[model samples]
Target: MMTCLCDAFFDDVARATHEVLESLGIEVIVPESQTCCGQPAFNGGDWASARQVIRHTLNVFQGDCPIIVPSGSCAAMSFHGALLAHEKETDLPQVQAFGARTWEICDFLRNGLGIESWEGRLDARVAIHSSCHSRGTGTPEAIRTLVGSIAGVTLLDFTQPEQCCGFGGTFSVTFPHISGSMGRLKIDSVRATHPDLLVSGDMSCLMHLNGLAEKQGSPLPVKHAIQVLRDARVTPVTVQ
Candidate 1:
């Protein structure tokens, strides 16, 4: 799934995900009617609107094919979040089936495709920020395994690798001061590692961190892990 954040602010991330999936010989199918996974409303305690949006999405993504989502937050919402919305309803069965077929892209690539290693090369000291929503979903481990498998990429160590980037969908806006402080702490941890690039499974987290980094004048470089893997396939031509 192309998340709202990715589609609006980071189109390249979705493109890179598409390219990487195709390179692995996976035929991707994106339904044109697909839209938000109802996360914003769900997180905001608006269940009526959330169910409306979730129903529309479920209709768009019908069938047994695995629904691969680039953002762990959205993937979780589509399945687990949707199930909660329809908990007492008769549609719960459908939501459970949908949950069974959903997967975050990295998780899909690692466990779904059985790809333990990527032979591509990109020499850089990389630090990872697995999204808060990715916890318990196996995305963190999948990211470590996949990124570590890249030949020349060195995974850097940093404090609080599990800390949230403070972009909890509407949580940031609801509590900007608390959100900003949390984000700064996360950035400080990453900066201490002195890595060449900051990587994450979620573009939303990167967007939040990138804004704080620029405001603080540190401006650390960042990219989605899929973009790193896609770029690693190429040979960089040096200008003479």
Candidate 2:
């Protein structure tokens, strides 16, 4: 799924996801009617509005095919959030079925495609931010394994690797001070490791951290995991 954040802010990440998936020979189908996963409303505690949005989402994305989502937050919202939105309704069964078909890109790459490691190389020290919503999704392991597999790619250790970057959809806007503080803490932890690039499955986290890092005058470079993979997979041309 091209998340609203990726669609709006990180079009490159969306393109990278499409390129990587197509490279794997997967017949990618993007329904034009697809919209936000209703995570903003859900996270904002507006179940009524979230249900309205997710119900439309459920109708738009109607195939039994695997629905690949790049963001853990949005992917989790599909199964977990949608269930909460449609609780006790007749649509619960369909929501459950939709959740079953949903897969985060990293999880799908590692498990669904049986890709254990990357043959390509990217010479950089990478720090992974396992987004808060990535929990229970098998994304942590998938991210570590995939990044660690690339030749010349060193996955560095950072404090609180599992910590949230403080972009909880509407949470950031609700409490900007707390959000900025949490973001600073995350940036500090990542800076301690001296990473060449900060990688994450969720662009929302990267967007928050990168912005904070820049405001603090550090400018932490970041990329979605799929973008890193796409770069690694591309064979560098010989100018000579």
Q: Among all windows of ten consecutive residues in candidate 2, which has the lowest summed lDDT?
A: 231-240
Once fitted onto the true fold, the runs of candidate 1 whose alpha carbons sit more than 4 angstroms away are 236-240
lDDT of each: 0.86, 0.87
User: Candidate 1: TM-score?
Assistant: 0.95
Task: For residues 63-94, write the lDDT of model 2, one tens digit per residue.
Answer: 89999999888889987888888887888998
- Score every model by TM-score: 0.95, 0.96
The local lDDT score (0 to 100) that residue 164 gets in candidate 2 is 77
